[model samples]
Target chain A: MGSLLQIAVRNVVRNVRRTAITLAALLLGVGVMVSIRGTLNGLQRSMKESMVLAQTGAVQVHKKGYLKNVLSSPLHLDMEVGDALVKRILAVPHVTAVAPRILFGGMVNLGDQTLFMATLALDPKREFEVCPKRRDLFDARAKAFGTSADGMVITVELAKGLGAKLTEPAALLAPDKDGALSGENATILGTMQLTSPGERKIGIVPLPLAQHLLKMEGRATELAIAVDDLENAPLVAAALERALGPEFEVHTWDNVATFFKDILFRQDFLLSLIATVFLVLMLLGVANTMLMSVLDRTREIGTMMALGVRRSRIVTLFLVEAAVIGVFGGCLGGLLGSIVVAWLHVRGIEVTMPTSAVPFVIQPFVDVLYIVKIVCLSGIGALVFAVYPAWRASRLRPVQALAGG
Target chain B: MALVELVGITKSYELGRTVVHALNGVDLQVERGEFTVVMGPSGSGKTTLLNIIGCLDRATAGTFRFDGEELGDRDFNDLAEIRNRKIGFIFQSFNLIPVLNVTENIEFPCLIRGDPKKALRERVRQVAEEVGLGKFLAHKPDELSGGQRQRVAIARALVTQPQVVLADEPTANLDSGTSEQIIDLMLELNAKENVTFLFSTHDPRVMAHARRVVHIADGRLVDGTDSGRAEVAAVAGMGAR
Candidate 1:
C-alpha cells in the first residue's frame, strides 16, 4: 500500500504543469472562502459595537407596551419608575451605570425652518455614566448640560438644515399626556454625528424640560443600562428583569437593534450562498482535470491493469493523487489566505454603509476555526470530486485499452 | 494439466451495433518452461489469445485453465489476483510506468502482491542482472534505449517468478538489433530459470527463436509445431559467446 502511494505521488509529480493548474483552482476556492468569511464576521462585530456605542447602552429597560408601539412614541406607554428603581438597577452585579430617558416625536422650529424629528430626553450628567464618549461628541460647555436646563443637542445634519448655531433658541411643539398641545423653547448647545437610518433628524434635550413639555413630569420612556462588559448584557438584562418584575421589559442591544439583527442574518445567508458557489465550481474543475488525466493515460492504465494491479488499487492511486493536490493546494491557500486576511484585518476595509449600513472602517477578522473549516472543505471536496474519474479509470478493460491507446 | 490451457476459446467485441468476433474456437496448451510464440498476421486474434492466457481478458465462450484451475467464471478481482500471483506481462510498447525507474518498475508486480520490500529489492537486483539491466536500474524508461527499455520490461516480468510470462508483440516497436537482443534475453531466461514464456508476434525471425510455435489465423489454431526448437537449440549454443 505504501509502495502504491509512492507511485501515486510520483505520477502526480510527473505531470507538474497539470497538477499546478489543479492546485491553483483549489487554492483559489479556499482563498475566496477565507476572505468572504472574515469580511462578514468583521462587519457583524463592527456593527454590534457601533450599535452599543451609539444609541443602545448594552441593554435597555422600558414599559411593557413601549417597544411594541415604539414607532408611535405614545406618552401613555412611558414608564413611571421612581428613583428607587434606578438605585436598585445600579446595584445589579454586572450593571455599571443607568440613565433614565424619555422619547417623543415633535417638530423643532428654528427661525423659519421647522424639522420634525424623534427626540431623546435624558439627564445630561447621568448620560456621561452610560456614554462617556458623548462628551467628545457634543463638545458642550459645563453649564449647557445643567440639571432642569432647557438645552438641546442636535445632529450636525439637522443643525445645518435648521441653519441654527450654538446658544440659539429653538422651539419644540408636541401633544402632551392630556391631549393638549404644548411647546417649549430651548437653546441649542452643540452638534454631533449619528449614522443610522432616520437618525439624521434626532435631537437631545434635558429630561426635565422633556417631561414638562410632554405633561409627563414623573415618567420616562426607558432606562438605558451600561454593563461592565458588552457580552454580559443578556445576563444583566435578565437580573434587571427579575428585579424590576412584570411591568418592565429588559432588552439586550442585539434585541433592540432590529435592523442590525436583520443585516447580520442576511450576511450569514450571503456568505453561505457564496461559499456553496465556490465549492461547486472547484469540484467541477477538479473532476474535469482528473477525467482528462484518465483519458490521457488510457494505455498506461491498461499496462498497469495487465501487470496484475487490482482495479480498486487503480482507483486508490487516482484518489491519492487528487488528495495530494488537495493537501498542497489547501496549505498554500491557507497561507495566502491568512496573509491577505491579516493584512485586511490590520489595515481595515473602508466601505460605505451600503454593505452593512454602518459607516466605519470594517476590519476583517480571521478566526482559526474558519481557517480549519476552509482546509477541510477544500480537501473533502477534492476527494469527492475525484471519485467518478477514479471509478472510470478503474473500469477500463485491459484488452480494449491496450489494443487501442 | 498444462501450465496454461485454453480449450475452444472464443472472444467477441461489441462495436456499436455489431459484434465482432476477435477469436473463435481456438485450442492450445503450453507446458511449464516452454518458450511459446503465437504467430499470425495482423487482425488474426494473436493478441486476443495472449490476453486470455495472461488473464488480462476473459474468453467470451471457452474454458481457460491456469495450473489446472478453471478461470472461465472467476470474478474480476479474483482473476486479477491470479494474474498478479501466477503470471507476468510484457507489452510491445515497452509499457514501463514512466514515473518509476527501472528498479521500481521491475519490482512493481511483487509490490502489487504486497511482498516485503527488502526481499523484493534483492529479487529485483538479481532479475535486473539476469536481464543485463543491473547498471540501468536507476534510469527511467525514456532515459534508456529501445533495447534497454525492453530489457527492463523483461526484468519486470521475471522478477515475480510467475509460472508464465506473457508478451504481446514484444518486439513490434524495436529495431532488428534490439529485437534480437530481447529475444536472446528471453531465450536465456527460459533455458536457465525455466520461466515459461507465451508471446504473440508476426515476425518470422522472432518465431525462429521460440521453442514452440503455435500458429493462429482468424481466431483458430492452424498449427502447433516443434520446428522452431531446432533454431532455439542453435541459438542456445551461440548464446554463450
Candidate 2:
C-alpha cells in the first residue's frame, strides 16, 4: 500500500501537465461554489446586521395581538417597568441595544385611491444613529419617513398612488369599531423606499404625533431588542418570554423581519440549487477525466500485470490514482475557493434593485466558513466521480490488453 | 526435473459464433538453464503457449507444471505471485510503461513485490548496467530508441532475478542489427545467470540464441529440435577465441 502510494504520487507529478488540467477544473468548480456560497451568505449577513444595527433591532417584543390584529392598540405598561426590563436585559452579557416603537393602523387616501397602511412612529434622533440612512429615504417617501420633528413620511408607492409629494398633506383615516371616521392632517415630512410589498404601503410619523393621531395615550406597540450575538437570539427570546410572561411574545429578527428572512431563504435556496448544478457538472467532469486516464494507461497496466502485478493490484493502482486526482483536485479547489471567497468578503458584490417602487439595492457581505464549504464540496464531488473509471481499469486482463493495445 | 512441462494442453477462445483453438493438446518440456524458442505464423498460437508457460494464462484443459507446481486457474493472487516472483516477460514492442523512467521501469515488478528500498535500488542499478541502460535511467520509454527500450524491457525482466524469462517476439519491432544485438544480450544473460529463457518468435536472430526450438502450426507442435544447441556451442567457441 505504501509503495503504491509512492508510485501514485510520482505518476501524478510526472504527468503534471495532464493532471493540471483536472486540477484546474476542480479549482474552477471550487471557486464558483465558494464565491456563490459566500455571496449569498454575505447578503444574508448584511441584511441581518443592518436589521440589528438599525432601530428595528434583533428581537421584537410585542403584545400577543400586535401582528394578528394590528388595531393600533398595544397595552402600555409603566415606563419604570420598561426601564427595569431594559436594565435586566442589559445585565445579560449579549444584549446590545433596545428601541421602542409605536404603530398605528390607518388608511391613506388621495382623490379616490385608498390603501391600508401602517403608520409607524419613530424617534428619528435615536433612529438615525441606529438606522443611519434616513436622508436617502427622505426624498422618496417625501414626508413619509425622514429626519424632521413635524409631518409624516409615506412609502414611495403609497405616496405616488395618493398623488402626494413633499410637504403635501396625505389624509390619514382611522375608524373606530362604531364606524366613526376620525381624520388627521399628516403633512409630508419625508419618504421611505420600501424593500417589500408590505412595507411599501407604509407611512411614518413622530411617536408623539402617531400616538395623538391614533388616540392611543402613552402606548407602544412593541419594544425592539438588539443583541450582540445573532446566534443568541433564541436564548434572548426565551429570557424575554420568562421576564415578560404570556401577555407578551418575544420575536427574533429572523421571525419579525419576514421580508428579510424570506429574502435570505430565497438566497439560500438559489445557492443550494447552483451548488447542486455545479456538483453534477463536476462529477461528470471527474468521471470523464478518470475514464480518459484509464484508457491512456491500459497498456501500461497490462505490462505491469505481465510483469507479475496482480489484477487486484492493478485495480487498486488505478483506484489509488483516481483517489490521488480527487484529493489533489479537491484540495486545489478548496484553496482557490477560499481565496476567492476571502476576496469577495473584502470587496463585496453589489446588485441594484429596480428604483421605481423599491429602492435599496441588494448587497452581499461574506465571511470565512462559506469558503471552507466550497472546498469540502469539491473534494466530495471529485471522490464521488472517480468510482467507475477505477473499476473499469481494474477489470482489464493482462494478456488481451497487451495483445490489443 | 524439467523446468517447464505441459501435458495435453488445449485452449479455446469464444469467437462470437464459434470457438477458436489457440492451443491444442500441446505436450512439451523445457530443461533448466535452457533457452527454448517457439516460432509460428500469426494465429498459430505461439503467444498463447508462451502465456500458458509463463502462467499469464491458464490452459482451457490440460496439465502444466512449472518447476513442479501445477498450473491451473485457482487464485488470481497466487497466479500473480507466481508471475511476479518467478517469471519475467519481454515483449516485442518493449512494453515499458510510458510514464516510468528507465530505472523505475526496471524496478516495477520488484516494487510491486514491495522489496526494500536499498535492495530495490541495488537490483535496479545492477540490471540497468547489465542491459547498458545506465545512462538512460531517467529517460521515459518514448525518450529511448527501440533498441534502448528493448534493453530496458530486458533489464526489467531480469531485475527481480526470476529463474525464467519469457520473451514474446522480443525483436519484432527492432532492425536486423538491433535484433541480433538484443538476441546476443539475452543469450549472454542466459549463460551468465543460468536463467531459463523462453521466447516466441519468427525472427531468425531470435532463433539463433535458442538451445532448443519448438515449431507450432495451426495450434499443434510440428517439430521440436536441437539444431539451436549446436549454434549456441559454436557461438561460445567464437567467444572463447
Candidate 3:
C-alpha cells in the first residue's frame, strides 16, 4: 500500500501541466463557492437587521382580526393597554420590553395646505428601548424629543407637502371611536427620513396624545416586543402567544416582513443552482484528465499487472492520485477565498437600490469550520468523479494493454 | 515433479469473423534449474507459449501444472498470486517504470506482495549487485543506456527469487554487444544461483547460450522432443567454454 501511494504521487507529478490545469479548475470552483456564500450570508444579515430595527421589533402582538384590516387601522379592534397585560407579556421567558402603539390614517393641516398621513403613535421612551436604532432616523436636533413634549414628528416629504416648519402648530384630524370627526392641535417638533421615498408620508406622535384625540384612552392597536436574542424571536413569539391566549396573534419579524422573506428564499435557491453547476463542471474536468492519464499509461499498467500487481491496487493508485489533487487544490482555494472575504469584510460592499434612499453596507464573513467542510467536500467530489476512470484502468487485460501504445 | 508441465495447449483469438489459432496441441515439460529457450520465427507461437507459461493469459484448451498445482481453471486473482510467488517476467522493451529509479523498479514485485520493506530493500540491493547494477541504483530508466536499463529489468526479475523467470524476447531492443552481455549475465545467474530460466527468441546468438532450445514453427514444435535432457547436457558442455 505504501509503495502504491508512492507510485500514485509520482504519476500525478509526472505530467505537471495536466495536473496543474485540473488543480486550477478545482481551485476556481471552490473559491467562487466560498466567496459567493460569504457575500450572500452578509446580504441576508444586513436585510434582517434593517427590517428588525427600522420597521418591526423582534416580535409584534395584535388583537384578533386586526391584521386582516390592518390597512384601515380599525379602532374597533384595538386592545386595552393596561399594567396587567404588560406584566403578563414581560413574564414570557426571553421578552425584554414591550411598546404599545396606535397606527391610524389622518390628515395634517398647516394652515394653508392639508395632506393625508399614516401616523404611528407610540410611547417614545419604550419604543426607543424596543427598537434602539429607531431614534437614528430623526435629525440630530430632535434626538431629545420624547413623551414630555406635546409635539408630532412628520416625515420630511409630508412636512414639505404641508409647507410646515419645526416649532409651528398643526391640526391633526381623524375619526374617533364612535365614527365622529375629532381634532387635536400640536407643534411640529422635527422631521424624519425613511429608507424608501414612497413611504415618507408617515408621522410619529406620543401615545397618550393620539389616544386622547381619537377618544380611545388607554387602548392601542398593537404591542411591539423585544427579546434578548434576535435569532430566538420566533420561539419568544410562540411563548407569548401561548401565554396571552388565542385572542391575540403573535408575529416574529420574518412573519411581519413577508416580502423580505420571499426575497431571501429566492436568493438561496439561486445560490444553490450556482453551486451545483460549479460542482458538475469541476467533476467533468477532473474525470476527463484522469481518463487521459489512464490511456497514456496503458503499457505501464500492463507491465505492472504482468509483474503481479492486483487489479484493486491499480484502482487504488488512480483514486489516490485524484485525492492528492483534491486536497491540495481545496486548501489553496480556501486560502485564497479567505483572503478575499477578509478584505471585502473590512472594506465593505455597499449596495444601492434605485428605490431605496440609503445604501446598505454588507460585511461578508465565513467561519473556519465552514471552510474545512468545503475542503473535505471537494476531496470527496474528486474521488467520486475518478471512480469510472480508475475502474477502466483496472479492467484492462494485461496482454492487450501490453500491446497498446 | 517438473517445475512446469503443459499438455495439448491450444490458444485461439477471434478477429472479426474468423478464428486464429496461435498455439495448437503442444506438450512440454521443464525440470527445475534449467536454462531453456523456445526458438521460432515471427508468426510462430513463441509469444503465446510464453504468455501461457508466465500466467499472463490462459490457454484456450489445455492442462497446465506449475510446481505440482493445476492452473487450468484458476481465476485472474489466483493466477496473479501464483505469478507473484512463483514466476518473474522480463519484457523486450526493458519496461522499467520511468518514474522509478533502479532500486525502486527492482523492489516493485516484492512490494506488491506486501513484503517487509526493510528486508526487501536489503534484498533489492543484493539483487542489484548481482546484476552489476549496484552503481546505477539511483538512475531512472531514461537516464541509463540500453544495456544498463536491461540490467535493471533483470534485477527486477531476479529480486523476487521466483522458481522460474520468463523473458519474451528480452534482448530484442538492445544492440548486439549489449544483447551478448545480457545473455551472458542470465547464463551466469542460471549457473551460479540455480534459477530456472525460460525465454522465447529467434536470435541465434541468444539461442546458442541456452542449454536447451526447442524449435517451433506455425504453432507446434517441429522437433519431436519434450524434455531434451541429453541435449541440455551436450549444450551445457559447449556453453561452459
C-alpha TM-score for every candidate: 0.88, 0.87, 0.87
Superposed by TM-score, candidate 1 places the C-alpha of residue B148 at a distance from the truth, in angstroms, of: 2.6
The local lDDT score (0 to 100) that residue B48 gets in candidate 2 is: 95
Model 1 residue B104 CA deviation (Å) reads 2.4
Docking class of 2: medium
Cα RMSD (Å) per model? Answer: 3.7, 3.9, 3.9
lDDT of model 2 at position B1? 79
Q: List, for all models, the DockQ compared with the true complex.
A: 0.68, 0.58, 0.67
Runs of candidate 2 with Cα error greater than 4 angstroms are A10-21, A53-55, A64-81, A109-115, A134-136, A140-150, A164-171, A175-185, A213-215, A229-235, A242-247, A326-349, A354-368, B223-241
Lowest lDDT sum, 10 consecutive residues, model 3 chain A, at: A191-200
**Residue B36 in candidate 1 has what lDDT?**
82
Candidate 3 residues lying further than 4 Å off, grouped into runs, are: A61-98, A104-119, A135-206, A226-229, A232-251, B224-227, B233-241
lDDT of 2 by residue, B147-189 (tens): 9999998998898888789999988999999988888898888
Native-structure RMSD, model 3: 3.9
> A285 in model 1: Cα distance from truth in Å?
2.0
Q: Clashes in model 1: which pairs?
A: none
Give one digit per residue, the lDDT tens place, for model 2 in A1-405. 565666667777666777788777777776677767666666566555655654366677777756665444433421322567667766766666665667656787665667888777776554554455444555644534444545677776777777744454466777532335677666766566643334567777776665556555455676766666779888988888887778877788777666766777787888888878877786677678778877877777777777777766666666666667766776677677667767766676665444333233334434556555565666556656776776776677777677654
- Give candidate 3's iRMS in Å, 1 decimal: 0.8
**Over 4 Å off, model 1:** A63-66, A72-94, A111-116, A132-148, A155-168, A175-182, A190-193, A198-200, A214-219, A238-248, A354-359, B16-18, B224-241
